[model samples]
Target: MKKIKIEPMELNAVKRVYLLGIGGIGMSAIARYYLHYGVPVAGYDRVSSDITQTLEAAGANIHYTDSVGAIPTAFLNREETLVIYTPAIPANHSELEYFRSNGFVLMKRAQVLGLLSSNYKTLAVAGTHGKTTTSTLLAHLLATSMGCDAFLGGISRNYSSNLILADQGKQLLVVEADEYDRSFLTLHPYLAIVTSVDADHLDIYGTYDAVLNAFQEFVSQIKPGGYLVVKQNIAFKPTVGKGVGVITYGFTPDCHYYPTNISIHDGLYRFTLVTPQGSINNLTLGVPGHYNLENAIAASAAALTLGVPTEKLAHGLESFRGVQRRFDVRYRGTKIIYIDDYAHHPSEIEALVRSVREVFPNRKITGIFQPHLYSRTRDFAGEFAAALDKLDKPIITEIYPARELPIEGVTSETIVKLMSNSNAQVVPKAELINWLKCNNVDILLTIGAGDIDRMISEIVNTLEAKENKAINE
Candidate 1:
């Protein structure tokens, strides 16, 4: 069996860090990591976002243009600077070429993160789905009990930042192990958690088996004698590291860790969490939705494995607010209940819609989904349609091409054509606000991973206007 070892970069030698895609969620976190140490930071992003703006305010020199001239003169010294880039950046990018030709040290975002986390005892959460929420909750639990640093995949409502710096001991670091581009392979964590292993990122893995293989390989990197806390019945049975003990958590009673006496009130759930040690009773989840129960279960199991005080469990979980865009409630008006989610996958959409129905029964559900990538739209058009059909009214928006070029026949209408719902239609983002203004909505869900979040404020304002109009009439 081949093993992976990450050699840590000597941070003492590097005077400054330069990032290629500085505005990215993951990239921005790394920039903050550098800034925390008082190291000089500079980067280039394709656009200026709140993330970039925040970085600029924090002593990071950032620009939106891709030109080599945008690079700061001070960072031009090859020996003193380290460059990190996201894989989403195109190969033909001029700035990337300039950095390459000039002999600057370049590493992927994951590689640089590996260098940073290499110093601390790492707790990593990896999966194609369910990782962000689970990791965020895990960070909260540990943060409350014993302070620990975290590099999360989403902006946590509790911390309002993806990077969580421990105020005291930096003994432990929690990281959301990203599977895109096989990036999770960087970490050899003290504890590793696998939340789900569904087929995704086909453009990168090429097949379902490859995705499984990558996950199996990821778990194999767990440190000797550490624990592997995984969801029961997941497809890829991990090949854990030497002396690694496997623990399972799931909805079923057969798992090592599971829930009991599950009950929902209004929208939130209260349940008794069952673990190998003993049962914790009268536990209430801070977030809404039944699907979040699995995520909570997984996080709790990991927390318990790391020796988190059992008494601190319930209070920590009750205070956990959840990650942004992971079933985030934008508006709860008398006329419309709006939720915005970052569910770009078919199975995720199905789960979100199913949970919405569970929470708001008998209410008319309208789902607004933007296809994230043309390749994904081409691959799972039928499945997407089936998931969207679960809603009373489904709106498919124009595809948001994040990193891939548009395919010839794959469009937002592709899913609409395959959908059985008579009310399903295509609405481009340019006219989405107008469509929302004219439409009647009961429980509205704006879903996707791209620029769909940009429309959330406008959609909420439109809903408010409609409510005020009905009152006036």
Candidate 2:
């Protein structure tokens, strides 16, 4: 919230861009955006991962250390360099301190996003669980039917990147509106979708009601005469400004936009998407998941509002591959199936398990879940236990602490102790693949929001080797 020497509207005045936490998903997308516009980009992160590697490949100067010397020399000139940072960066971070002392132009990632929305017709999707999938789907739908530039929170398997650049004509911007730390408040979208609002980030908001109130404020920020597309069954009912249009979508026909004649072939869905404009028959979602049917409806409504033809929407949906790590099926072996998902909250876990059960009926599901934060683990241990208990075999891993210090006695066992399912047990992330080697798994899921993703490739390889050895014997 510090006063910026150069506002995002004055981005052209800035000579270079530097990010504090360049490896983060949202931050990396912005870094890519600046790079695409021919700006010199540099940054610092605590660690390097696939995201940072990709950014480096795309002409970003990134370093893992926090030293001020780690910054590129070109970005050293405070007057010419704009520094963007994420909320995850700590107050004591040395590079952040150096930027503060040097009097550089500063902005939060969301602030720049708000500035972008001011220039284009913005379509934003906000929620606790389904925002990534919904927003990515909307971006794909718009990009294929018409054209759009998108800042996504997840890597799109179709685009293979989180940032999508719009072609010259009919530019629209699609963004995933994050609710954590009230970040989504910065956006005033022409079309906003709320997929779900659940009790999350208790570390920040402290109460479920606070989470609802923040979302309520978010919807109220939608531009007048714009559209509010929300789920019919979510707990919160939004209050929008005068002349703002409201549309509801869900599984049943009572909603404004719903699907009918749902059928599945080879794990993919074919259904009639019923919207107020008209129905798109035989629309096939490129991904498999019962939960995604609702996402499709929300995205489809937004796409239709923006003048996308029904035929183009249908074609786009059929070709749309989902975001990576959101019900991403890595491999399908004859005896073993491996999937990965970013389901950190209890509600997300429940939906994921339900969809997995429906998709691979009669297959035993063995899920490895790494809880994300200490506060969340402390606040929702029982709920998590109940949700994870739904898996035939639930393997709980060590908690991944992103920002907060650990609370005494709050560990992965915090959830396992509350579980009624005897099969549930705690394991360290380092030992997960070894555990997999010994255990029998029919359907395997690696689920979480943390570095648990780093273990995914090894897990898939282990499962594949196990299957091959079985056949050789």
Candidate 3:
């Protein structure tokens, strides 16, 4: 654990902090952090869930409605409070407008995080899929070695919380740099890791090239004398100045940091970490999934640059329980196994299916997937269909419209039509539970980045019951 000293920004004895979209994993971590600092926190979310209840129980005032009047009186005092919001929020949000018109010091969540990181020894992890897991691993590595305060994108299974180690003494800060809306650009980090530069957020970037350009812009923000670690085979070449050092890490030998002689024993991956200094052998990951191997390599590269000992790095990764919803194994039995993964992009889905095939070489894999956004489905219909077609039996659900309104010609049918596999079917969300009841499942996987999470518990329970009945018989 290493602590970097930051000059404290003086506040005018502000008694309250208000967060819009406070229920989001990243937003909630900030909320919890503010609460830990003894600031009275209050927030508004579009819906109520387990997270909001937890925050409310932990002493923050929360309401589900969007009514501007629902805001607490203390938070409404402009001179003594700060309002923070997420870009996922609709532009026309009433509370946002109220804060704006009233002259309150409103800031984007990324801006606030950037402001926090500017004064600390920050380690920001950026990518399309593995950011959360890599950031969590890096945070755990630093926290165990020295200490770090982290604001992560997913709840770490090890900590059961999205935030970890809030002490100011351990100058290290770990942040998940979200690529959506070009949010990662705000962070100026001491050590930064780019895990993947896949073309995601097409609606925002307009094209794959634009997305790559945004990532390049982000790389330029690395502080002078800082370290930048990038995954191998990424399309773009970064142009950097004198002080910053660049390192490449991946599964291939050309990378400065790569894995050597990888093997899976008893269902756990063991690989030698080949770094610039030397190779560290027999490194094991607590979480399953070969995609995570590359992520671990990337995290290890950055953490080593931050001065974590190779032995400590091995221990931290081995002890990591993984982030929730990233290849999360819910139930396992000899006859039936159920897994859920938050893989929405085509590349992610391909890697996920590949991992499953590798792990269970001879099993029948039945995959159910819910597409995340209408824009994404419309933009990558063929790619999505191709990825889903890889499975033995693929079930499709209606698009989960997170922020965008439904596009005219974009629907589940668009994707189903593109699939060459006849096993694919467009299924309604309501009928899925019953549908699965009658169907046979060997290795079941539910994949997506949307409300598919709402069904995880039910799906797990149903599969568990089937397993129990077979055992009893």
Q: What does candidate 2's lDDT look like per residue over 1-473, in tens digits? A: 11223464365568899999999999999899888878899999888899999999999999988898778898998778889999999999988888898888788999888886667778999999899999999999888878898999999999999999863477588999999989999999988999998899988998999999999999999888899999997888799999999999998878889999999988889998887766778889999888887788899988888888988988889889999999999989989999999999998999999999888899899999999999999999999999999999999999999998999999999899999999999989888889989989999999999888888789889999999999999
RMSD of each: 3.1, 2.6, 2.3
User: How does each model score on lDDT?
Assistant: 0.89, 0.89, 0.87
In terms of lDDT, the poorest run of 10 residues in model 1 is 1-10
**Which residue runs does candidate 1 get wrong by more than 4 Å?**
1-9
Higher-lDDT candidate of 2 and 3: 2
**Residue 29 C-alpha lDDT in model 2:** 93
For candidate 2, which ten residues in a row score worst on lDDT?
1-10
The candidates, ranked best first by TM-score, are 2, 1, 3
